[model samples]
Target chain A: MASYLPTPDLSHLKSADYHNVYEPAEDSFLLLDALELEAPFLNDQLQPRWCLEVGAGSGIVSTFLAGQVLGSRAVDFGTCFVVTDLNPRALPVTQATWARNGLALHRLHCIQTDFIRGWRPAAQGFDVLVFNPPYVVTSPEEVGSQPRGRGGIDGRQVIDQFLPIVPTILSDRGVFYLVLIEQNRPQEIISIMRDQYGLLGSIVAQRKAGIEYLYIVKFSRDTSTT
Target chain B: MRLLTHNMLQCHVKSCNDPALNFPLQFQEVELEQIEAEENEALLLNLVGKIDWPALVQTTSELGITGLPPTKPDVVKNDPALMKRLHEILLETNVAQGKMVCRGCGHSYPIKDGIPNMLLAEHEI
Candidate 1:
């Protein structure tokens, strides 16, 4: 299923484009794998009203989900795509990537902000959310100064800040897909979502790519328990 | 940014917060473009139930749009005209460039080439 739909094209992006924005790699492709697996379920049943990717870098991941998972009949489903990224450079890079893929930009709205900070609900809350955060451990002081792919202090500096906001924004049937490394403590992270936020989480897919052992974890409100 | 999106955004600057009127951020010297899209009644119907009509009305007014009803109405499944108007205003009308100012604390966010930059100063957040 991974290669059935080709990984999106990045040939058009100039070398200068990769300076600040994250160049798509194993973590990004790992996320695409998870979304590919969920594509059938997302289209067949969820029919989400709003889908978002927070801290979207290069826009490839959200673009993949839009074309692959949300189905091309998005307008009829009334699904809106909101892509947020703090780096101003990444947003434009995202648009270029989407345009190259032959997807319409009219349906997707890109907002430059810190991880969904000022966004309120539109119609219903977001039903499908994805984040491939900056997960490389670095000093906490260096967190915001860097561009794309540097997570401070156990690689959870950025990821931890986002966890609490998930249960607040996700719809009743909502699901959030997040990518992490082994050092990010997947077990503890899942337990925290379940015990603290009341959102059930499990690792949906995992792979050892290069030197990084990547994991894609999904969280949703457990109807059986809640 | 589209008006539907502007409706969802407000002043996130912690000092000038919500549970207060910081939203429908007043538009100033804006540029708008109408990007045509197909009207989807099913999507509209699913979305209408959750829209905050007053906020949307305020946002449209900021853009000098006065066509929407003062208040949201009951489901008009058969009313194609109303559906088109809603679809047009909410999804089709795009804000290409502008400035959104907070009413609470007078903070401003800029919109350039169609995307709204909602970043605030460190002190604000």
Candidate 2:
């Protein structure tokens, strides 16, 4: 069946809010499309119990996943959705997005932390993880600077910091979806996940938007018994 | 703050690393408000496995709201009344105003206008 999850009502967010928090754009919608493509697998096969969205800006992506994919299940599957962002202003916006979608705050949690630095109780790894990192190639100093969408030299600074910890933070059957541009060296990232982390990576969806070719790369632990 | 959000939160203070002291931050003073929301039993059941039931029970008790059993009952799936109560605890009840105090470090995080202030000082970060 074609996925028909309604795009969340973000009309509640005003331009003033967008000044600091990210406005939903093509990159965000592309991530939503990728998730929609895998909705059936996520719903029936994975039955994901815990989902984490890193750098959840407008909170639209994670909200969609909770409201559309998992929420469609007949059983009260109770998926816990947690989101983290470096921008403190993004937390409230994320919460508003959740409220706007008729989803309560009970199953959703938002924390204003940088790149999972304070993540403790390591044993409680997530079953589904998604990240739409800043992949624009820019000066190194711009990585964490104000207007926080710049990815440092090679456009992989944030991605690099998050990659090594994937295996450690993911459950045995967990799947991670990440967004990257061609400039970020997608092949090297796929290789690193395979050769170093023992996780298989593949591009699940890609689209050329303007000058940037965006890809949604999905990774999971290599479970093939060969 | 919803109990679901409270369930995942821990005291992130730098010196407060002890697990026992971190979780289920004590709700010192809270203002409760109920907002109507669409009921979805499937979503509620989906959340049961992820919630720390005992922590939730303790939090509700501390907040002076009781009726949750000491532990999560296996019959929740068969009991609609229990499921409805769970829905109220998790989704309907909101912490409108209050402060969440860390049990270990004794740091207080305030809630204003239904939003919890989780930002820590530079030294805490």
Best by TM-score: 1
lDDT of 2 at A212: 90
Off by over 4 Å in 2: A1-9, A67-71, A74-76, A98-107, A115-125, A145-148, B79-81, B117-125
Worst 10 residues of 2 chain A by lDDT: A115-124
Put down candidate 1 lDDT per residue, A47-159, tens digits, no spaces.
Answer: 88789898778778877877766656676686778899988888888888888987777667899998887886444378899998889888988787235667899999989
Model 1 segments beyond 4 Å from truth? A121-124, B18-20
Q: Which prediction has the highest lDDT against the true structure? A: 1
Per-residue lDDT for B1-125 in model 2, tens only? Answer: 66666665677888888888877788877888887656777667766756788888989888787778898897688888888888888878888789889899998877766656666887996
TM-score of each: 0.94, 0.83
Candidate 2, residues A1-226, lDDT tens digits: the string is: 2337778889999998888887887778888888999888898888887788988788899889988767645235656777888776787888889889877676676666665544445335788999999888999988772345889999999899899988887888899999999999999999999999999999988888889999999999998854
Residue pairs with colliding backbones in model 2 are A76-B42, A76-B45, A76-B46, A77-B46, A78-B46, A78-B47
- Candidate 2 — what's its lDDT? 0.80
TM-score of 2: 0.83
